[model samples]
Target: MKFFDELKARGIIDALSNEEELEKKFNEGGMSFYCGYDPTARSLQLGNLFTIITCMRFQKAGHKPYMLVGGATGMIGDPSGKSEERNLLDMETLKENIDAIRKQLGLFVDFECGDNAAVLVNNADWWQGLGFLEFLRTIGKRFRVNEMLNKDSVKSRIESDSGISLTEFSYQVLQAYDFVTLNKLHNVSLQIGGSDQWGNMTAGTDLTRKMNQNQVYCMTMPLVTDQNGKKFGKSAGNAVFLDGSMTSPYKMYQFLLNQDDAIIDALLKYYTFLSLDEIAELDSKTKNEPHLRLAQKSLAQEVTKLVHGQEGLDAALRATQFFFGEKIENVSDADVASIFEDTPSVELSSEMLNEGGVIDMLSETPLFKSKKEVRRAIDQKGIYINNVAIEGPTQTLSKADLASETALVLRKGKKNYCVVKFK
Candidate 1:
């Protein structure tokens, strides 16, 4: 398949301005393209993953990709898809966010691929030195206030209760000037963004044509949403950040693993580099045997590997298996802690274990409500110590039973589990 054809086949293109011309340019090859990311947060969230992957796809097709960090524009937030004006970040926070995001982008794009290697550029480098008068006479003269007001980003905000701020209202103009600057400095001819960025992206193309008389292009990918129409990349109102410290690899894997089956096929298209035939095969299996969750597992594995690398994927798998009757006898203390990080836990002094056995321990902790409940659970063979079924309530917890001499794994029936840490 041709490069552009593959992009369309994978459902990556939401809308492209001047498709015929862009298609010709793509076929000729060696076009430089850019996607802008604002430093609004400490890490790029799952919402940003699709654009990064698109850049990777373009780079693999022999095009140079520019990862543009909006250091200047981030200080004045973009109003697209926002309900109200965003809080401005101080210079310290913006710089920290830019540095962190640059590192994360490196994981996705090849920075050493010779000519086509991805380049990281910050808008602040150009915007910082321009005086207000120069900016007004040069870039500002090209924009009309009436046209700016017609933009969806501005129109929606103007009608809202909070209204629009002049700072945010001029964001499209800044983004437009970025295109002109990139065109002049890097010969960048294409800009890619999310569907919500359609207005801002078109503004850039327009400014580029008016200023440089160059035909630059803009393409957008559809905003990802779940079966319920909720956007992806959020968990409990907080975004799923790319940084492992912000959103753990284990948690990211679980989030993908738990995706609704109804949305898995579409998600596979957006999230993975798997071939269409491979995805089709997985889709068939999903329909035939939904219980196995073949598609969901593959999506989790592929995306987790992309974001966190192979070792992170392995850790996520290990964390997952820990709950599914996996043996805990040889598990490391840190691994055990990570696996049960979200599970119920009780810390007990080392001396408590010597007073009695497993029965005495359960009677004291909240794992069991009362001694009678503990006895009942043991009688039904529903209790496990270190993943080994307890013979009865009398079966004692010796030092030998502790995994890594730090913790004991206790389970009730098939799903519920708790960790007992010895201090």
Candidate 2:
């Protein structure tokens, strides 16, 4: 399929400026394209994943892709889609962030290849050297204040209690200047971003045409959300970071694997490059056995492999198996620790285990409702240690019960697993 056609099929084409003209330019082949990333944080979130992948796809289709890290504009945060003004980053912090982002981008695309070789750019390179008066004369004069006030990003903030700042209000003009710079220096013809960027992206296209009388393309991908309409890419109030240090590979794997059934199809379409035939088969399998969650697993595998690589993907799969699969009894303590590294854990003193009964530990540690409940569970043979059933009614804990001299795995039922670490 043609690249744009594929984009539409995958539901990645949320908006495009002058579709026919853009298609004509794309047909010319070897066109230049660019995507921007703001260094608002130390690491990019999963929300940034699809856009970076889109840039890679453009390169694969024989177009040059330039990845722009917003070093200059990042210091002055974009007011687009914001409810309040963002604090500006210091120049030193922004430079460090830019370098970190560039390293992360290198893992996905190559830079040594010719023609369609991927390029890394920092907008500060140009934005820093320009005199304030000169910028106003050249780029600033092209944009009208009334025209800027009408964009949705600006209007929403204006209508709210948390008003926009002048610095953030000028974001569209700065972004437009990014497009103009890329077009002039690299011959880039297209700019792509999330749906939130529609107004700013169009501004870039308009500025390029008016300033140099040249045609450019603009496209955006829709916002991703869960079945209940909650946004994706966040875990427990924090964003799921692409960097392993920020978010572990195991956690990233689980994020995709646990996707709600309603959102899996859309996610598969946007994230994976699975062939149409393969996707159809997966879809059929899903319809036939929704409970099996085959499609969700496939989506998780493909995405995990793409972002974290094979080793990371394997660790994630191992984690899944240890958590939900059979043969838990055969697993090692080290493996269990690896899988449940970030989970809530309790620490108990060895002396307490030796002097106190199982009931006392269960009640005192808040693992059970009461001593009576603990007795009932024990009577039903539901209490287990390291997947082995306990036989003694007067079971007294000892150092030997601790796994690896410091930890004990508690299994209250088939699914509930807890760990007690010795201090």
Candidate 3:
């Protein structure tokens, strides 16, 4: 399949400025394109991952990628997807976020490859030196208020209870100039963004045409949404951040692992670099044997490894094993905390270990109601301390049972887990 055709086939390309021309250009040869991200938070959300992967798809097809960190535009706050004005980000936070995201983006695209290697840029690099008056006269004059007012992003804000700010109103004009700048600097011919940013993207194409006399193009990806059509991101409910600290590898793995079968295919295509044939095989497995959850497992593994490294994937897999009643070994207190964050927990004094055997201790907590209940569970080999069934009702507690420094993982069965923490 042709490059553009395959993208459409996968539903990667949602809107294009000119389909025929863009398709021809895409097939012709290696060209330069760009995608922008704003430093709105300390870490990029899963929604932004869609754009980064799209850039990778183009880069693989022999195109150069210019990843523009919206340092300048972020200061003004793009009104594209907002129902209300966003609180402006401070310089310190924005710079910190930009640096953090730069490292994350590098993991996906090759920076060492020769001509088509990825290049990172900050709009602040250009905007920092230019004075306000020069910006207005040079780039601002081209955008007319009436046309800007008609843009869906702007129009929606105008109709809202809190009207758009002048700073936000000029965000499109600033972003539009970014295309011309990239075109002048890197000979970039195309720009891509999420569908919600179509208006902002078109403004860039139009601005590039008028300012630089370059027929640059814009394409938008449909918002990476859940099956219910709600936009997927922090605001969508769960803040599935790419950063490990904000959202643990276990949580991230669970998010993808629990994806609905209805959208599993699209999730696989969008989130992973697995080939169409590989995805097709998974799709078949899903239809024929969804009870196995092979597709969800693959999707979880691929994305977790991509965002986190091999070690993180291993950690997520280990975390998964733990939930299924595997013995916990060599895991840290923080990891243990993350694994059973949502499960019930029973805290005990470190002194209690000296007073009780395993059954005596188990009976004290809510894992079992009484000593008799605990003994019966042990008789059936159904009770576990750190995933090891008690040898008998008389099994004693010891320091060796602690999975971490001060925590012991307790479970009644495969699904019921409770953490026993030493106070």
Give one digit per residue, the lDDT tens place, for model 1 in 332-401.
6766665677788888878766635777788777678898999999899998887789887667666787
Off by over 4 Å in 2: 233-238, 325-344, 349-364, 369-380, 386-408
Give residue 273's lDDT in candidate 1 (0 to 100): 93
Q: lDDT of each structure? A: 0.87, 0.80, 0.87
Against the hidden reference, what TM-scores do the models get?
0.91, 0.87, 0.92
- What's the residue-level lDDT of 199 in candidate 3? 87
- Every model's Cα RMSD, please? 2.6, 3.5, 2.2
Worst ten in a row by lDDT for model 2: 323-332
List residue ranges in candidate 3 displaced over 4 A.
Answer: 353-356, 359-381, 392-394
**Whose lDDT is higher: candidate 2's or candidate 3's?**
3
Residue range 252-300, candidate 3, lDDT tens digits: 9998898889999998988888888899999999999999999999999
- lDDT tens readout by residue for model 2, 72-181: 88988877656788877887887788888899999887787888899999898999899999999998899989999999999999999988888999999999999999
Backbone clashes in candidate 3 total: 0
